[model samples]
Target: MATTNNIDNKRYQGLIISIALFLSLIGALLAFTFYTSSLLERNTALIDQTNQVANSAQAVIKDLFDLESSYGEDISSPHIQRVLTRLEENTALITNSLSAIEQGGVITDNLGNRYQLPNISNDARLDVAEAKEQWNVLEPKIQTYLKDANNIMVSSADELAQAVDQAKTSSLFINESLDKLTRDVFSNAERQATTIRLIQVLGVAAIFAYFLIFVFFFVRRLRETDAEALAARRETQEIMQTVNTGLFLLDKDLKIGQQHSRALNKIVGEENLAGENFTNVLRGRISDKDLNTTKQFIEQLYNPRVKEKLVDSLNPLTKVLLHNTSGTGSDSRFLDFKFSRVYEDKDIARILVNVNDVSDAVYLEQRLEKERSQNDMQIEMLTTILNVKPKVIHEFISNTKAHIEKMNNILKNPGSSQYELEAKLKAIYRDMHSLKGDASALKLHSFTKIASDAEDKLSALQNQGALSGNDFLQLAVHLDDLLSLSNTIEMLGERINQTSAASTKAAHTTPTATAAGVRAAGAIDSTPQANSQVIGSLDFDEGEDIDLDDESDSHLLAYYQDFAQDIASRQGKEVQLNSATLEQVQIPERLKKTVKEISIQLVRNAIVHGIEPPTDRRSAGKPSTGNISLEMQSVGQDFIVSLQDDGQGIDYDSIRQKLVELGRFSLEEAEQLDRNQLLKQLFSSGFSTKDEADEDGGRGVGLDIIKTQVKESNGKLNVNSELGEMTRFVITLPKAS
Candidate 1:
């Protein structure tokens, strides 16, 4: 197509050139013709002027001769009257011819009629002036003769004779001058005729040359166009036959082009699809929905309002699935369809459609998806074995079981009282939080997923300030999933345990050397020149008096101290944990559990939420390591567990915003809320200042669970914080009776 268009363009340019040449030739011919015609007209005028001069000269001469003869024959005859009139006419003619000779042509007026005289060439002007001089002398003689002849007297005969003689002499001189002037006029006319003929010949020759050149160019262009058309036809046939992909063109009306790949028939399951509407050919192969969608898509592709690529995603034929009906068996195949605009000149002339079979690719993707699921399961198992401690896993399973039992017991309670229901929701929230925390700590995503979902519903119940038994029943699905997963994980745990035990036994059995032999090998060789020496030794004083701080009494504090420091380190902060001695004050076993849980929760919360990192603390002109203190004491009937942190205090605005995010109140209402109300919402489930959920914090369930635990022990929890100064949580539990 491109070659053919190039040939056509060349032919068009050649035609324009030929037209221009032809116009130039015509213009030249017209100019020469006009010039030749003017020359011929001038020649004809000169010839006529010469002829008139000659005739006038002859007339004057004839009239003078007759007058002289008449005067000789009869001096007083009546013939003189006729001769005088004839001479006067001839005289007027001679005068006009003389003027014509002086002016170079027959003079004409604005009306194109001859004036008083014909114009003659100025080259003969001198001759015409001399003739006029001669005529001037002859005219008076003829007039005197005419006057004498008219008297009719014998005495006037001699006067007539004298007049006739003078007239005859002047007439001879006039005749000679007229002849000279006529010859010069004839010479000039001949030269003008020759010029006209030469111009005529040259103009004809030039026109012939222009004609020949135009014909040559025209024929050459025609031949080139034919050759280009033939070449294009051959190339197009080769492309149509050899290309494997289904390629075709569609016009604005969606009619397929005449030439298409042989593969098109196999792809579309149609033969001889050329000249047919593309939509019709596709209708039987693809669903009607796709057909309509494809029609609109192609229509949009033809729009010039935006770039084609911008709307490429709207193409419906992309990855279109078509059934392969050519084969004997009934099966489906996916064909990839693509479209692009074909431009002719600067306009889009057609849309090119390309189809390819992608069934193998589609099937491969399906298989890959199945394998990916299997890989995910294997990875989950590997993670469980690597990261989770057996002890944590065991405890998680046991605790989850107990929590589920507690939830079941709450559901089993038949009381429909709103207050009782609210209490049950609070209890359920604590149990779910504890389970979620254990799952999160152990990195068991499956358990955490189920527990977090249940926690969400229980939180909604707490927000309602009431709940029904049906609400508890709604939670059964999550609980069931958790229970089922727990059993599966417990079995896996047993298998893991068995594998560990076998590995330990195999290691013990594989050992060959005794303890003494190993020690001797480890002991520096004391042989001569050995390069090993013992640098350190163990010392024991078994009989010496010993004094050691009672670690048992401070174990709870120490464990939490270590926990705080570790959490701070992981978060890139430094922290110092200080605790008052609580060994002297007796704590009951149940109260001890409460204190320990509260201390662990508060300590972690302080480090995660309150304490700034070392950089922040130093920037604030404070110690690099934050300070966290745990103090326990009893006052009358209340046992106080106070936890304080010398770090950033609670931001009440942040708490308000969290409440606003949970949709409990608008931002305006939240801001208007009192500080006490804002602090109280810290115990609201799923309300945390942290933006993301992670293993350490941001679940917001810690304080809520702690509040539940305090309530169960008949205690009160109080929070006090000064911005940028300190944050403290005071827990007061009733002393055991």
Candidate 2:
């Protein structure tokens, strides 16, 4: 043991040493990389300095070349020699700086990166040698030549001037040769410097790479350290096995499942959970029926919808399979189960079913349920009695009650299965259908048919049952659509009622005839100009009930003549609201009074809502103030009097939401209704979308008065607003044949 300990300590010591060595190597490489980079930067800066000198040298050469090109040979003449001497001095300074730069390993700027240059040591030496040798050979010869030439030039006068022409050619040739030699020398120096710079760069890159490799290992070490920390979690798992729950594991078939422990003595057979079917162990122990119920429950848990880990509703041991989604037990029973879906190493699902049996608790629950059921029944009976004098919201109340009552039945019938789901859905459809029938019986035609249509749609998918996920989604969407339409219808009715009351007040204030027989002349105009083709049509696959509250057909011309003649004469147009009616449409007293009041009012409204000024009308391609039309027609037992306009149609949704905001209804309620229903509120008393506070559209008694008078005589008011298009209010009254 002592030897082993010694070795282990040595091994750990070695590891620490290795770690230190690794760190040291990294630091050294980093330092080397930095050092090399600094050297290169200094050298590069030196190279740049040398290059600037070279550029200056080239500029001097170019000046010499320019001078040669312009003057035709006489450059060596005393007049030009002074200029040549000045250029040579500048060249000497530039060459010396270049030689110093090529000797460097370090020549850096403030930012330390190596400028690219070659170590031109050997080439620079050769250049210095060549220049020295050339200067030595030429210096004495040039001095001797210059003295002789100067003596001759001074003495010869006109003859010396002639020699100047000859000297220029020789001088230009010499300058050219010198420039070529300088360029060749500089090129060799640049090439040698480039080679040295590249070698240094590669060496630095190798050092940088070594540092990166060391960092990579350091990062890997951190991950290994983190993995070593999970040892405590393994210990916690060990403690969990001793927990005292009557836990047993079940295979797919629930036989002596792969895992069972001493804690499950009562639930299983023998010391070992011998390979036996789970049902056999419970057989004759907790009634075969209950035993089978537990087995079947395991099967269901094995195949769950939306993937689950625990089932709160599990039945007791029984032979007959049972499901307890509605919660089984006598009165107050509590069965909380936690079933973990275990998988083999291959991830196949097995179950560890944990059950907590609390029948006493269940017995208590049943008692409460019975009490609740009794209370609900009592409410239903009272509501039924109240239906005899049903208010306007009778349908609404009944539907809500029906929804609540269906819950108990659904719970009791657990066909906790696909069939039961289909059955429940069928029941729901039937209720909605019955509600529609009831609405129709009450003359709530607007609300009835939409619900019936929705029911029919659901019945088509009943065969698929709740197990069909697609079916459930489809049903939900349909229900949402139906609910939305229902809300619209209800809102429309409330709006009409409000409008009628307001209009009644308006009629009283205006001193309009109260009796049905009052003569209210309507203007009949020329035929409407709109194309008869329908732009958009809503198709339900089954069919849609046509809402016939529109104001188009023959006999519209007469209405225009009745109303517009009074206004057009002022403009000197002599416009006639002409008509061709098959009959002087005699309206019922109930409808007749509403038509008189509204037709007269709308004619005046046209003066405001429809017509532009005479000048404006002329510019707009109209004769004058636009014509207003009132048309009446007969279909079956109803007389339809429609007030039509060629004016800006209202924005019903905005107006509806606004009215709801103003405390008429909530946004949620208003949104459910369609545009037709929203517009119905326009006739409502004291309700208007306008913020301008006008007496016209909002007379504190708009179309609502018209609706009440019609309704008082057993008639109905229908509103149709084709916003920005035109708005027409159709009043229908039963003919007294």
Candidate 3:
């Protein structure tokens, strides 16, 4: 076995030597590779420097040539002539403009270097001047010798070279040593040929040995690495699929590229967006645009002059682009799209377009906008409601419908006469006038606007004024609008009723016939004076209602006597009632009921109880008559009513004495009370100072009843009395709202 092992060892020696040689070759090759890479990097850098220098020099030469060309081109424009003339006339102004332009007044462009702008800055203008001066001096001369220009240029070059050579000692690039260095660097590859060949021979030997060992292990490891790479690619794809936003990948051609999410696929499939052009996609799914615009945006990719975003094709506001992923609209809920540039240099260069569906977010945003508009309208409605008196506004709605109901009445009785037409128009005018006053009082601008227009039309018709075709057309349209507004008020009023609980407003309050009578009776200024042409122009005749009664057959005395006799007969007692001013009283329409009720009550009370019997009146040295008088007067903001009787005056001392006897007040308190306070006891609710004794009638609530009734009519009541003489009550109530 030992001898066999020895033979085996000898046979393997050659293999071992081969392995050693292979390992040695690997180290040699790696070092050579590193050295070659460094040399290549240096060469690349030098080449880049040479290119930059050439490009810069070429740009300067081109700029100068452009300047010369531009100067030649602008010789005839009006603006160019103007600028030239001005420059010639005022060189100092141009100098000042130049100074202002030169002093750091420019914005640096994208590369952080200033390109003095053409219109406003000094550099462009300076170039213009320089170009102009040279061209002005030489252009005309050069044009004359055009064929011989090239020959002249060649001669000029020879002369220039000789002149430069004359100053050789001062030349920048022409020294002997510098010339040699430049030549070596730029021109001589063969100069180092032998040395380079030796290096190459050594390098080849080393590399051959090294590659043997390197390839064996490298090939083995490559298989394992490739397996890991496949696994990583699978993981990346899985992550993209699992991300929260819906995704739609697009190709550079802008077709429905690819979809990862179920939701995204459904939208595209439902919309038929897969093969449609992007701009015309508005037809199918409303990607909502021109396809060419979308394509153009995608084409920009990441052109730096614009935004440095991948979506060069679309608004960055609504869309975005990422290398492999993009989202649009709400970040949390994307309705946006992205176009990404990936690996542009390789054949794999592609646009990875992404889309995110933001339907719910967009819907919510629209809903909010709609709600805002509604809220603004609601505020306007509330402002309108605030402008009107609640009662008038309510009536406007309720009464307008009633007034419109009259239209049906007119329709039923449709008769046309010039006179009847005038009456019908006047009725319409009354309603319109009421509308105008109510609208004006409320400062309701919209309501007044509609009502005034209706009124003017009616007024024109009523007065037999001309109604041109346009006027009638406008009137019909306007009246329709007013009628529509009336219905709106009714609808709004219904809403108001639903929301408000405490209002005394009835549905409609119309003008009463009695109220019209009141206007007729009280407004005597409408009566014509004999000499006056216009009736109602005279001031009110105050003496007209006055009656110092004379004849018993007269209206004034007959009314008084009849009223008194009725009281006396009703009470089974004699009562003499007189009006210092009865027929003289100009009764308002609203005051008719109130005046009658108050007058009768006062006279009856005096006849029944306020007086003694007729015998007592006679004994008191008065006629056997219980005398009462009524007077009326108009005062500021109110009408005053006075009722006076000389039957038996109210006894104030008795009232104070009774208040003390009752448990309501102390004798000391009664003693301190004034006469007015004592008299007020008679008007107290329950406890009366006067009782139903000594053949007189009292229920203990007479004055209280009087006070209650007066207060109910929104009136104030007070009494003044003199013992055994006259007693009087004064009442006042408002005449208007």
Candidate 4:
């Protein structure tokens, strides 16, 4: 403030000085003008006096010659007297004018206006004194001539001639002196005029120099101020460039300021962002919704009534996903934008925007979240494995491993054409769907979720316009996850079996109980082939030779019963499995896996699709518990496995509606199809009556699996359904050699 005051004081002082100088210049100009006017007046007067004196001297010479000529003319003539009188008057005028020229006195013109004439220069005075002396000498002769001519007209001619000669010589000398005096006076006036002009020129140059000096100082001060401002701006630019965060100013119009941080370019993957509209900058980078919200948020910042902190949570740009298209390719980034109001005094002027690239941080956070979810899933899986029966878990793990292996093989040879790729996808989808169903039955939710996710991927691939090898690349990642999960479950299953074995050995109980415990443990530890061998040991190949009371056969029936009950409980239905017929007849070792696979799929399909919920059953005046019967028989060289469920039978109308809904067939075409054709449609891959797929039967892959299994086994499948009565599937396979 003191410095400012000092500068102000200096400015005031300069202004005062300038004013004084200007006034002095005006005064000097006035004085010079007055002086020049006075000099011109005096010079005019002197030249007028000089010209009058020269005119008077010439008149005297002419009058003197006229007097002598009058003497030669008639002496008695009146012209002679008139000439003498005019000569006396002219002589008197020349004497008075020369006297005025020689000294400072008033002179009169022909108009009788008197003017004061200053004393002449030395040269003019000398000429004036010589002219006066000649006039003094000539005046007496002129007077004598006038007296003589008036007295005697016929007097001595010689005397008259002598007087004339004296008058002529005197007159000639006086006129010569008067002419020299006139030249001298005019020369002096010219010299004085030149000197005055020189002075005026010098005064003008001095004023111009002063003005130039004032301008130089004023401009210098301005340059200093500009330098300070420029230095400050340079410093600001350096800070802006050095900062990592994108920084800029936004006005109320949503336009960016002229100056912005250099990092703004790098963060936004753009250049020359200055002066661009803020919305245009963020337009393509963010969603339209976020961009509009950001605009409003910034406008709010410019409002003083809106507390900046209160609206901070409403910032839509916080962790915004921006797709930057300014680079060679589109790059996605997560950016955080913060706005602060720039206040000038009490009013908000601009909004300061700070943008930061939070992609890495957000990505890291997402990865951490994923890891936590995966850990929770693993824990849930471990808990599930512990609660499940060892035999069931063992069988589930083996079947899952087989399905995953098949999927991996399918992925390995994705084929070249679109048709071939789609076929591979459907094959993998069937395997994944089957795996999902089994996992859902065992309550291994982690496995079921993975399988379901994989099925979704395959379904997407199947729906695409065309398929390529690259299209299946993402599926490989999902397969790896499934493979990893299966391995973890297998490890958990082995550990549980070992722990159970240890607990059984430590109990030291009865031999029978111990053997049962050993058998259960052995089943879990057994490989897929080993488990099949154990089933083959039952030897229930032919209907007459089977033992109904065999413990292994009972375990097989119990397995199916438990599986059916678990699926019913999940679907909110009540089911009672009657495997009495199945106990009487069993399949060969070669058909054990096929029969198990077929039975599991058929049982889930019945509980999920065929069985009505308990409330519905009660409302229909039927028992709340739905009945499912399993039976196996051998006819000649073929063994038949059958599964029947007594619930709401197959709804062919629902199948037809689903066909029309899926765009597979028009309504007229579907209505014209018979029951067998509808069933054939139901068995097709990717066909489902269910609107949405869950962990269970909605995938439509269950029946496809049964169809594939029967085909591979070189068997026949028969389906029978009585609406609202029952639905049954019979599978016939040639008896193993």
TM-score to true structure, per model: 0.46, 0.22, 0.26, 0.53
For residue 615, what is the lDDT in candidate 3? 86
Best by lDDT: 4
Query: Candidate 4: misplaced stretches above 4 Å?
Result: 1-244, 249-255, 259-271, 277-333, 338-353, 412-422, 493-589, 611-648, 722-726, 730-737
Q: Give per-residue CA lDDT, model 3, range 522-641, as digits (tens).
A: 842321232133311221232233131221212433444554565466456777667766656555546534554454445545655476567887888988867777777668778777
Stretches of model 3 off by over 4 angstroms after superposition: 1-218, 248-252, 255-263, 270-283, 287-290, 309-334, 339-352, 388-490, 497-501, 504-737
Worst 10 residues of 2 by lDDT: 527-536
lDDT of each: 0.71, 0.49, 0.49, 0.78
Clashes of each: 9, 66, 12, 0
Q: Is candidate 1 or candidate 3 better by TM-score?
A: 1
lDDT of prediction 2: 0.49
lDDT of 4 by residue, 97-166 (tens): 7777677778777788887777778988899899889878767766665566656634645555666787
lDDT of 1 by residue, 1-737 (tens): 67769976775986887788788878877887787676666656655665665676667667666765565465335676676676676666667656665765455533576633334566567777877787676666555555655555534455445555665676566667667766776676677667767876777787788789778977887788789888988898888788888999988899999988988877677787999998876776788999998888888878877588977788887777776545643356688888998877667789998988777888899799868854664456446654543433555577788888888787787768887877777777777777765565445666776787887677567666546778778888888877877777777756655554444344344435553465468953322122112111111122322222221343455545656766676678888888775545556545755675566678778988999988888899989989998888879988899999989999988888778887889988997889888877888655789987554577677898788779889898888889999999999999873
Best by the TM-score measure:
4
Candidate 4 weakest ten by summed lDDT: 537-546
Top-down TM-score ranking: 4, 1, 3, 2
